[model samples]
Target: MANIEFFDRTMLEAMSLLAESRRYLTDKAEAESQKMDLEQGLANSMETMRLVARLTQVLAWLLTHRAVHAGEMSIAEATVPDRRLGGRDLCAKDSSDAAKTLPDELQSLLSRSHSLYLRIARLDDQATARAEINTKVSGGPRPQ
Candidate 1:
């Protein structure tokens, strides 16, 4: 009867240890999952920032061109409207001509903006790949 009791206590202790180990593994897996999610979020945020920077650069170039063109048009003599059209048409023509003759500096800025956009796109793709990898790592079957 004493041997039977001893065996029962040993079985209970073994089960308790197994339960504790399982809980520890579960907690560890949860922590790792949280870490992966955080990393993915950070990568997404970084990609968004890169996109914002590219857009800002493009907008700045456009604004600068508009400002410079407006200044030049302000000093020029306005043309009279033809008999077939209104006075606004003459100003529109002048503005169109001015746009066609953008300064070299403005062209350079546009080129740089295009390059920046391409770089941002590449970085976004890289971030997406990294996030996918992290997701797979956290969710996939454990290694032996």
Candidate 2:
């Protein structure tokens, strides 16, 4: 299905970006972190956490959708609050001023992860809306 293809593409992109971010964070960023002043170092650490959180949320949502597509999870199950896209308060928060001074690679990772999370959040909202509409139309789930 067209929607499946979209998710597949998105999943691949997220995976690629996540891997790149990990490499940069574990290698270059870790080394550069020691060179920063206390304030900047704290900012870098916080931003790094934000970046990881964004990607983790994105990946989790994508995997849930993937499970639904694979028939491993019902649409209703995936729409549940616990399974839905989360971390909006933190993941969607704007980067701090001090974060702007972080390494170029880290800044780029934060930007990319934020953008990806926003896109996936939109998808989650759309999917949940559609599920609600279907439930309304069918007058709730039938016996299974």
Give the best candidate by TM-score. Answer: 2
Q: What are the RMSDs of all candidates, in order?
A: 34.0, 2.3
**Model 2, span 1-144: residue lDDT tens:** 898888888999999999999799877987899999999998988998899899999999999999989999877778888888999999988784556789988888888888889898898998888777778897987223
**Model 1 C-alpha lDDT per residue in residues 97-118, reported as the tens digit of each score:** 2222333332333334335444
* Candidate 1 lowest-lDDT run of ten: 75-84
lDDT of each: 0.36, 0.87
* Candidate 2: clashing pairs of residues: none
How far residue 116's Cα lies from its native spot in candidate 2, in Å, is 0.4
* Cα RMSD of predicted structure 2: 2.3
Cα displacement (angstroms), candidate 2, residue 123, comes to 0.5
